[model samples]
Target: MKMKFEFQFPDIGEGIHEGVITKWLVKEGDMIKEGDSVAEVETDKVTTEIPSPKTGKIIELKASNGDTIHVGDVFVVIDTEGSAEEVSSEDKKDTLAEKKEIVEEENAGVVGEVISSSEVIAPSDEKEGNSASENVAGKALATPVARKLAKDLGVDINKVVGSGPNGRVMKEDIIKASKQPSEAEHKEVLDETVKTTVDAKEEKIIVEEEKIERIPLTRIRKTISQKMTQSRFTIPHTTAMDEIDVTQLYEFRKKYKDSLKEEEINLTFMPFIIKATISVLKKMPEFNATLDEENDELILKKFYHIGIATDTDRGLMVPVIRDADRLSIIELAKKVDEVSNSAKNNQIELKDLKGSSFTITNYGSIGGYYGIPIINYPESAILGVGRIVQKPVVKDDEIVKAWILPLSLSYDHRIIDGASGARFLNMMRELLENPEMLLLKA
Candidate 1:
């Protein structure tokens, strides 16, 4: 008797509704184990691996590479033991399979490609009717992340109790499973002799001409584009430009650089700006609020949690500092360093990017002197910090060199008026002008 399992698209991250399949690791008829990586999925914030849930032969692939699949949509089918030809012949004789194939093919290539054949087997009526039993046994479902986590942590998801809604296994379940010794007991169960070694002597170097293939944007990228378009149209944006004299701050940083270095803290100018921003946010609370559409409310957040926009090779990612107001300058600097490094390495988690009251983008680090940053939607304002340059300034009748740091603030007119926005900008200006104020606050 052969067992069939249909694996659905799992939740890749927090609040993620869908994902675009970037590539499939295995094709139909390929044999796969429970922990084998099956596909790569790109969510709004990250690209992650989707792993197999059961040990079986690939009988059918529901979605193709570059296809956008919603969470809970069946994507792949596996038969515990069977040839692809046998499965296809079985599917063709089933009426329900014919209808399902037609509908699936239509939606497959729209966002991705669909690979189909008559050899795939359709689930029998008795098996379809037994879904309730499968659900009860926790064999009918698992999210992509849950499945991946289970594999990574050496957890037996089938035996572990689920705490999530509908008895679904979650990340926590995998973490809990990691603490048990039994999880690793089956590590050497696979047939080691079946592994094939590469033949270096027979390998030949072949170079093919490079070709370019233009692929359409995945579902998450499309949604990001749409949201950015809506934000540009809805908000009447104006940039307020000013220069901050950060000479004193620069001197302060140099003096403490060695001390911070000894403690393994990379003291950058970002910490100074973050500390100053918190002080400024305290004076101008409106900049830290968001417009609540459902309640028609202007939600003013008294607490500060600043988001630092970090540009990665893939795209832009903004990870938030939780409770920026409560953290000391050193602590804030350390958090920024940790989050920025994680974002660059594609190791940042979904929860790290949520619930930010305001945002700051430091393009100055990369030699940009000025930029009009887009407001990170729902958040009322965003501050852009530019490069600090040494320029000539008049001091009482004489020319003197001063360090000037350019700043631009963009805010939503719906929640923050022009006057409020200007005041917020001025408050930030004052803090940057006198770096001592930041030390006082710290």
Candidate 2:
């Protein structure tokens, strides 16, 4: 006896309630082994491949591409027996009814009804005896307009081949059938219908479309939009901007940048900035805290997990470096590279994206100068690093060239006042200006 199994879409990542079926790896009738990838689902957190739970022949795909599948919804149906031999018509009906019952029971209280595919399974020995029209009582599934057109042209709607979802007869199918030699008397009516159909289609396209191209937001982009909107609306934001003369710090980094590369570590100014910010966060506890609205309290984070805002092809992703305060500058450099590359390549784990006490966005490397970065909500503050440029400055009463680094610190004004925000940034400037001061904290 063949056993039918309905594979439900499992809970993939944390807090993932739903996912869009991006692609189908295996189609109906394809034999798949256990652990074989069946589809790629794009959730808000990540795009991951869903694997088959059992080795079997795919009897039907319950969900279509671009369909939103909720948790506990049946995604695919499989026949564990894996045999292509046809069963009796009576057995087929019983099997389908049984499968429908199982799907309804499993998906009860879920999003949509689990409707079985109308497409018949293949490898049947009989031809006309097992036809879909015969099975469905010789009724050709069609739209109302299609049925009307067939009647107008004196064409037998049931005899006309349907080229639509579940073998539904369409207007085009009727028009094609009417053009046949047997239906020679209906050519005049068919010509008129085709003209009306073409004109209507063209008019619909012109009416619905705009001059500009439209693109749908990806899963990550949509999540970013929602988060940014929430953070902007919920938090009272205030930004403090300043420029630090890091001439000595610039020379210091220039001196050892290549030497560190020998150890296969790509050193950037971000690690130095991260180290300096961590020290300042320690002194200013309010800046490293979250506002618990319900409790009416400030939750100070004892541990530092710095979120590094990185740019990738998908969108902006912040992969956190856990226990940031405990790592040495060299170790910070390595960790920075590791998490950044993982985020850029879309291989970073969901845990790495969470648990950040504070976030640092480096628009500097991308040539952006002084942006009022939004605070990653629940985190009290965010540090924005701008482009480092050289300018003339007074040094011992003499105007000389110095490397000036622009910084922007945006804080949650509800907890951290304007004065505290400025003070927090000034401390970072003091440490970054004097590169050696970072060594004390590192």
Give the clash count for each candidate.
Answer: 9, 0
**lDDT tens per residue, model 2, 218-237:** 66776677677768899989
Candidate 1, pairs of clashing residues: 10-144, 67-111, 67-112, 87-119, 87-120, 87-121, 88-118, 88-119, 88-120
- The candidate scoring highest on lDDT is 2
Global Cα lDDT for candidate 1? 0.68
Each prediction's RMSD over C-alphas, in Å, is 17.5, 10.2
Lowest summed lDDT across 10 adjacent residues in model 1 is found at 106-115
Residue-level lDDT of model 1, residues 1-442, one tens digit each, is 5556768777654656566688899999999998899998877666788998778888788765655576665678888664332233245434433332211221211011111212221233212322212343235234444554566445677776665633445566666766665645556574432222222222222223433232344443554565566567767677777787778878888899889999999988888888888887777777788777888888889878888988777567788898987887788879999999898887877788777888999999899998999887777889999998999988799998988888989988776777876777677777777778767765
Q: Model 1, stretches more than 4 Å misplaced? A: 27-31, 81-215, 293-296
